[model samples]
Target chain A: MTNAPIFERMALIGIGLIGSSLAQAARQRGLVKEIAISTRSEATLRRAEELGLGDSYSVDAAVAVEGADLVILCVPVGANEAIAKWIAPALKKGAILTDAGSTKGSVVAQVAPHVPEGVHFIPGHPIAGTEQSGPDAGFPTLFDQRWCILTPPENTDPDALEKLKAFWQGCGSDVDLMDPKHHDLVLAIVSHLPHVIAYNIVGTADDLEAVTKSEVIKYSASGFRDFTRLAASDPIMWRDVCLNNKDAILEMLARFSEDLSALQRAIRWGDGDKLFEMFTRTRSIRRSIIEAGQETDAPDFGRHSGD
Target chain B: MTNAPIFERMALIGIGLIGSSLAQAARQRGLVKEIAISTRSEATLRRAEELGLGDSYSVDAAVAVEGADLVILCVPVGANEAIAKWIAPALKKGAILTDAGSTKGSVVAQVAPHVPEGVHFIPGHPIAGTEQSGPDAGFPTLFDQRWCILTPPENTDPDALEKLKAFWQGCGSDVDLMDPKHHDLVLAIVSHLPHVIAYNIVGTADDLEAVTKSEVIKYSASGFRDFTRLAASDPIMWRDVCLNNKDAILEMLARFSEDLSALQRAIRWGDGDKLFEMFTRTRSIRRSIIEAGQETDAPDFGRHSGD
Candidate 1:
């Protein structure tokens, strides 16, 4: 049986991976009656049209958001303020305005001032993605079984909040509500820290004079390739994440560096027990993640043998 | 169309993941006429027998090595010295002795002193494994398309080294030869440092007082889950690697920490261009790895949609 549409019109401000995926998911699941897609680049908008990702496409953010009941800013967090200002006047009355950026506190700070009256301003982040980006990297099932966290302002109306949560649910995501500040802190440790570490380690490998780049690529399967996937994430998006989540990210980085120094000292002293203890404790966290259905149970992420 | 066996008798001194996989691969490819397995623990030896991983199973290391023309020490690097001392007298005069440990310098230093006259001692590392350990974690194709680096001591018998290389090739691996010291340095950056960084980041996440463990686990799919695969690797094996490859690992860790400091500075100072440049450069390495057949090209390591 088909479900009724949750919103009359859902406008995606940037037709990148997240925007394209949302359009496909909303359309395939009958979550929205019409999907209006927009991006600054004419070629990308034409490609989105060719893919039939939305009912309408435009290069102007205002034109895309006009008469839309749901407007999602899916651009990089760095581009939020400009798009928010450009589309604020065109946002329909009583529309739910949200975002799919990774950092929430910054998005609220950048977009809240420009939001029109009667528009419900909520910030969101989908805890799901692939290494690749761009519109072609999206799929209809990208949000299945993934979490979409919402950080609504304190004065948000309950009906608007409920509707947005229901809309995400219809697109096959579990919804959680969190304070924007707390969201930034938690994401710093879980998401930002990992990406920063991956990028740093890859940069270190790339600059090694003793070890050639060819050697790193040849032997990456041993361990190095695991970090490359995270390092290969969109540069603009990650740059914005690092810039916007500065305080929390810096705090997490400081802690990680401190711990790494202790580990380095342990190795210098040949303390095998300390190393083993640290390695063993982390295994349980991955186990819990797998049991919670947040990660794949397949060994090496099921890269081999497809098991 | 089948080739003749490379060695008349093959002795595997530790029946863990590497040893068990070698047993299966050698047997499946007809690389040896007879296989003998041994481990220090009686339970492990019995388990190896139950799995029929070898033609004969023994608890005594010397008994397994007697009359074997090819002896591979598959234990942790720290255990190489004692095992080498124990099995030195039993190894045949013309036998080729090797290991599958991650650290080559330490393996050479530990296993070389005990090699009897005319015994060809070659330290080898197969750059392949999963996070799982023990016999049940092994499969015949574990080394398929993987590189196996052999660090042969000076003046090693050419015929013996050729035989060892041919055996690994039969098991579906390309073999590279290098000096023991260089192998350790190369692995420190490509394999050991990545694992150490992964372990450190996971430790940092686990000890965070600001973020609950439940929250970290719940939001791990964002980016944290990628590091968990490497963090969940066999603790004992990794511990041995840290202790045995002390100098090289310390050098790589120092480089990694330095790069991380610069990255942190970029983030704190709002240097978005620097962050973007660093993130953009590492993407090409993953692409090169995929092109080299060292990594899976599927997005997210083929975890979703199985592309």
Candidate 2:
């Protein structure tokens, strides 16, 4: 199941978590002959060089994309448009241009217009990450057993799309094809809404006048610790997600709020049957997620295994 | 660091996750000389016996409590009253009667009146568990490095409290004491609200018309899977928590909803700065939780370690 080099030269536009992981995965799996990495941050570019993440590293994204047959925009979703406009002229003819943004519709809306006529613009989201960020936070196995959803534009070259899919598979990811708008909607519920709720709940706990923060920290293992992992994610990235996918996120938020109000009502009225029914039904989703191999079956995510 | 048998005979009134874990923990640590187990369900009692979780098993709470020096009510918070009344006469003189329920105030309210003379009734909550339940879910290490908070009445004998604390320490948990009401409030934020929010979000995802359940399941690794762990907790226990700790849970839910509304408005208005600031501040709490040893520092709760 090993892959030959799918692209002679692959350019990475940001050397953050996703970028660094992609570089390592591609190199380890021989997915690309050469990798040229660029980030706007001088320290990050320097760190990428120090880590030997690619064959070439540069602060100027335009220089890195020169002659690169495959270019991936790995910065936050909000940073895609400027990078797209900056590198469009330097893109190789017949090159496949893609992104690893969390929101495909937003990435498409931002970067599609700037893509060169001959470039293949396919937006994608790898549904994998940790709370940590930066080049230092990535490992080659980050995408192992994870789903990477690609939203290739209409009229996209089938060969180019297939090549991109193979590239992701080479990096140890299961590739899924989805429409850009539908991808946004799905991510809005699965990712964006969860992050927003986690942030909101953590904020609520922090603002509590009645309960001390020390108490919250000391007893978090009961449940709050789980949400904190999502809450502790990169702020700038999540803020961008909130801004870029506003419509779908807000719709999911509305539904969540409506559901919370109903749960609140059940508690206030002591409707044990209603509360039990709601809690009972939600358990099946976790089982389904585990059966899908998207989640570990180990208890507490096996966080306590070290004990 | 180790304990001799603290109690000659210990009675467990439920054989679910917490009860079975307690039986194993106490037996493995030599905290009790003999263990007696009971539950309303005859099948569960038979399963408990087959698992060798205790020296004696009974469906009769009274029969299990006879001659036991310590008795723990480990049923759902809502079931405490009837169990208390049934076991009150059988409880040995000077026995320490405690509970492993999540909500302290509710346990105290439900079980205190049924306490017989000379029986020390302390409401305790061990902030440890997985999404799994039943006798087979029990493990000796379940409570290791976790917190067990005991809320003893003001007039209670100090020796009984100390002995109960020692028993939990034998089970490998640190002990903290708080007023029952304060314990309820603290738990409402750290445990109850988180579970409530998780259940609400999972239910909302289930009821979505636009997104298919298969889609949510396939892509849950992004964030939705974290909440699913809490949402998959025992329904009866959570139902009782809502019914019993109504006021504190309601207050926390109100705060969570209010903060969520503000987050929604920020998303609607596209206020990236506000979202960033809120998201940034919450990161510190998670750091504190990790530093305080309340959470695993490993990213994604080390769920991806297997990959």
Candidate 3:
């Protein structure tokens, strides 16, 4: 663990899975000297307090940001503008304000206008999560071996950028700096499109009256179970992601639909070779993911020993 | 364990994951008096013999079924007709011949004509399997607490049906009898379609030139890795499933594409409500699956101990 503190105080404006995880990681490695948590709901704020996620908890966003050297907007992407407006006045001079939003461009656009001249605005996304949400859904090692992409504007202060990168490094993440637009595009194909497809398929299976609901549940082992986990993600969070990342999501969806149409035609024409080729090609991508160490090579259910 | 033998000699015609699992389950519980195994490939037969999955092993299907009272065809669906013809002459009088093919109606259509008179043909499918395959993948508890659906012909012998049902029960499966057409339809939606969609998405992602493939691999934790596991399934087996179960698969594919189109439009129009409702509903299906014990409630990699 790094002995040097990354920030004097860190303000987290939503103590959900990402925020609580950041808190846990920060405290475990002494990345920050103190943490303040704020959320719209008092119950969630109380829960964060119960979990010892921060030194202070409040429902008022501005109150939480006061005196904090680092402020992270950990709310859903849709709430970014409102949270930014609320905290803009209380943000400390020369403080670094970042985010853990899924959609980078929208977050940059929404929060950039509210940033005071001295504060550094770096939009970041920590590419890690579970199906579960809330303060209890966090762990100290959640960011270990994960990637955190920082989409800092070209004119951002160099010192602030370096300090923020140090914080993520202390949280056990390898940082990648990229343009916000490119980050959104990359995420659309890898994350947003997959979630939309999963949600749609689960909804389609749910609407099937001919196939008894129980039967779908009973036989989900084949392939549907994989989609179910992604589909079961927080609805509010996903909704905001789709609404915010529209252009890139649509472009990826268009390519996916085009490919799916080709597959459908092959299946209709009984093109065994085409189907076999596609299925065969996909297997190598999975092998690459396993080799990259981003995913476990374990059999189903092997990695969640404690959970 | 059931002490009464269901068949004098039970012949498993292919000693892959399903075949070897069935052999292990039967032997552990003494469901058969003797076991005979065979495969067209000499290597697979040797592997099965080394694993001691049967009392005897043969390269010729006819040789393995010579004295067998029950012959279970465990090869891929594509090989059903060929294996049925090869072993037809050697099958004992009044033998009950069944299969563990994924697509029941196609297997019935292909294999029924080759079955000789006095031999009862009862095609069945056990709704159980892992991503793994071959004799080395077999485990004694593979079938425990799983569903096994039998799609016997309407006029098939009652005694033969009962014997097959008892056999599946002894192998640790709860048996459900359904019409062959309905079984195919149900499986197309539940199993076949999901695998096809997974394979397609993984292929789509792999073909992208804009995003470096390494980026996709590194960030797979954002839901792409889940699909990779399903996409990594055996290509030949899935190809056979796609070809043998053509009509039903095509039907489900059409529905999936249509649903996906609606979802694509929702994302395009920034309809957060529609996305939220679809995402929320899908979560309930996952909850029901977990409650029904069809899947583990543990974290993604936590459920299975072996990788």
DockQ of each: 0.90, 0.91, 0.73
Alpha-carbon runs more than 4 Å astray in model 2: none
Please, what's the RMSD in Å of model 2? Answer: 1.1
Output the TM-score of candidate 3. Answer: 0.96
Please state what fraction of the native interface contacts candidate 3 reproduces: 0.80
All candidates: TM-score: 0.99, 0.99, 0.96
Worst window of 10 by summed lDDT in candidate 2 chain A:
A298-307
Which CAPRI quality tier does the interface of model 3 achieve?
Answer: medium
For model 2, residues B103-193, the per-residue Cα lDDT tens digits are 8887877789989999999889999999999999889989988999999999989999989999999999999999999999999999999
Candidates arranged by DockQ, highest first: 2, 1, 3
Error of 2 at A4 (Å): 1.8
Candidate 1 docks with a DockQ of: 0.90
Output the worst ten-in-a-row residue range by lDDT, candidate 1 chain A.
A298-307
- Write the residue-wise lDDT of candidate 3 on A1-307 in tens digits: 6568979999999989899999999999999999999999999999999888899999999999999999999999999999999899999999999999999999988999999989999999999888888899887888878899999898888999999999998888899999988888889888998898888888888888779888898877766777888888899999999999999988888888889889888878888898788878876787788787777765543422232
Off by over 4 Å in 1: none
Interface RMSD of each: 0.8, 0.7, 1.5
Question: For model 3, what is the alpha-carbon lDDT of residue B153?
Answer: 84
